[model samples]
Target: MARTRQPEVSNDVTRLITQIRAMIGKGEELPPERLLADQLKVKRHRLRLALETMRDAAELPRPIIRRNDSPVLKSDVVVQGTNALEVIELRIVLEPAIARLAAVRASPVQIAKILEAATTPQGVTRTIGDIAFHKLLADSSGNQLAASLYAFLRRVGSDHRLHVPTASAITSERIQQRDQEHRAIAEAIAARSPDAAEQAMRQHLRRVQREIADRLNPLETA
Candidate 1:
């Protein structure tokens, strides 16, 4: 006669994912299950459910995986030579999936951070804000494997667009358009619409890839 309640494992999973992200970012290994459960003030059973979910997502032998130590994969497929194009290719593959997860799993605080980053001012803050906004999406996704791979991709040989002079690449109109695009993606995620979020992210990344291509080959546009 009474409605059955879902096991409280989702909250536990979110908490564990949050802690694991922080720990891995600092190069700190996760403590044993018993210790973590005690520290998190959760029962072992709930903690175990969360731990198992995370373990499956990780699929790694070790708890804390450092970025530098990750194995390099040799792929004969897709664009691989140019750093900028390669980074764009990976974004096309991963960002939409991450956004879809973020739509369902992101916490209130995480959403707030994403919003804040999206609205942050340009100049020095622009670069940092852009980085934070994207990283926060991955963090919100609650998928450590995706998050870690995104992190590694950001650090590896890429366009390093942040360091490159923004004078040419970042025009005033471009900045305005980017703000609108980011807000659209953020809105989709905050509204918890996975399909919308995925589409929004995909559209944004495609625009970026196109811009880079056009820049690299002005003759193509001509």
Candidate 2:
């Protein structure tokens, strides 16, 4: 029997997707059609087609919008408010289970990647890097359903960050605190203690949720 050849992607489309992936991987916001066309050295139509294909293939996630269907603007106060609420809801539903599975199934290499992502000293905290870590943790959990759910939750988190201010108020002390929490989670996983890992992760997420809520509702903070 003859082997069937795979469909080849056009050079232009491939190049455009590469550029788009690079921008997304670095957590950079993409510009609109005209700017993307210029950056990718392609026609506007080609760029649009490439983007559409990538989105359809799930390489690019869908945009989150407001009630009127306007794309959420990153600097808009209303978008930030919406994001603050959404992130809290997502974390409460996702992290505990992921942590439990990670404790049972994460291999040494996967655990190391999670620890490195959590501990890295980058000038700007990269949301992509953090997300990659979480995804890896989910994969390591050896549960397909948990992994899929984590992926969805991560997209929501990414959209929220894109439309909202991140922890601009993150101080050195706060970073250290986060690092410690991550370490505790990692250690519990390494020890194969599912209960401990889940508890640690839940505690960390609750702390993060409270901080974000406090920022969103200063009256709560008071």
Candidate topping TM-score: 1
- State the weakest 10-residue window (summed lDDT) of model 1: 158-167
Show model 2 residue runs off by greater than 4 Å. Answer: 1-83, 123-126, 160-168
Tens digits of lDDT, candidate 1, 31-55: 7878978887888887777666655
- How high is the lDDT of residue 108 in model 2? 70
| TM-score (all chains, Cα) for each model | 0.62, 0.58
Per-residue lDDT tens digits for candidate 2, residues 39-87, read 7777888887778877566444444333584544433453455565576
**How close to the true structure is residue 116 of candidate 1, measured as C-alpha lDDT?**
62
Candidate 2 clashing pairs? none
Report how far off residue 95 is in candidate 2 (Å).
Answer: 1.3
